[model samples]
Target: MRQQIVEAREKAAKDGIRVQRARTPAPDVAAPVGEVTEATEPFQDNGTLRTISARYDLTGQRELLWIANEGKKVGDARCTQKFQFSNNTTPRERPTMLLCWRTSQDKSVVVLAVTPEGRPDTRDAVAKLDTRWSAMG
Candidate 1:
């Protein structure tokens, strides 16, 4: 997956697509949850524009960035959106594409359950988020 991130960014650059990433502050190792340092990996994805080092909780899922394909500037159009592949996945399938973006001040992970355009399936999942990342509010 990490290798894919690297390759994807390279590809995006060649295609003139912007990419981004972000990560939360690292925990103290014994901070209850798990090591969060791995969340700060470098952005070597081949086709990325802006790589943000952040994390998001979708529903109850601790989402991680596996790939960031493209990015659109905030308020440049409607939303601060980017194409991404999330590490969180079900037992039935692999990590899929999602719209990891901001709608207000909160960032969110819009899971693409089954939209021909790959839209977020759970509306409330994004609504519950505090960061500016959402689709339809």
Candidate 2:
């Protein structure tokens, strides 16, 4: 997992995009299980800044609640167990997508992808992360 993040950063740099560690404040909710691992970076996409982030090791109903609450704070949030992804968008502001799933290793994961309003939807970006991370055990 760490390797993937490193490769992503390197790839962004090679593409002439400046990627920076996301500086958003952590959510107020506390995790009750294993330590949560997070990796986030904001980079330029077609002249617009976009963000991609992931949190790992979440394991409980409380964590799911946290995800739901956080998504609600942003926009109309919807979660699907089958797809293991959440959709949240603030059409008045930005478009964001959140995905959560239990890995083969039994670890719960959440990923977020965001793009400025007026840009394309974040489905593709979130889907890419879903495909990449879902394979990790």
Candidate 3:
């Protein structure tokens, strides 16, 4: 438990990830049985390093904007990204979270999803981001 933190910190430094204050989600021993076990960050591709904080347990297409906003809210981390996963047979195509920063500009976001069956679907996540960014302004 504690060792994971130390190891992650070391890896982050190597990846240029500065965890101002890294906090690992404590095990939810009381959580309902079979509920994704405890801890968040699984949704971030399980990279040993932490370039950014991620949440998936309660995270969804809805929170995409929130996370992106947090990134944009800070400094010029303007170029932000997020990934969402779904295990359903029918997946939604509605672009989510600050999708396109500027259509005129070449910058765009890419959304990738993986199913419980190990299938992959990647698309533009910036289309919705553009909408959310507009609303924020």
TM-score winner:
2
1-137, model 3: which lDDT tens digit per residue? 99999999999999997665322223552222222211212222332111111122222222232232333322212323342233222223333222222211212222222233322212223333343334434
Off by over 4 Å in 1: 1-62, 76-97, 102-114, 117-137
Query: 8-127, model 2: which lDDT tens digit per residue?
Result: 999999999875432222466454445555556552253222222234444333324334332322122223222222233212223333343333334544544444433433355445
Expressed as tens digits, the lDDT of each residue in 1-137 for candidate 1 is 99999899999999997664443323532222322211121112221112121233222223323323333332321121242232333222222223333321333333222232433323322332222233224
Q: Distance (Å) between predicted and true CA of 57, model 2?
A: 7.1
Q: State the weakest 10-residue window (summed lDDT) of model 3.
A: 47-56
Candidate 3 off by > 4 Å: 22-137
lDDT of 2: 0.41
Per-model TM-score versus the true fold: 0.22, 0.35, 0.19
**Global fold similarity of model 1 (TM-score):** 0.22
Candidate 1 lDDT at 44 equals 21
What are the Cα lDDT values of the candidates?
0.32, 0.41, 0.30
C-alpha lDDT of residue 36 in model 2: 51
Residue 119 alpha-carbon offset, candidate 3, angstroms: 28
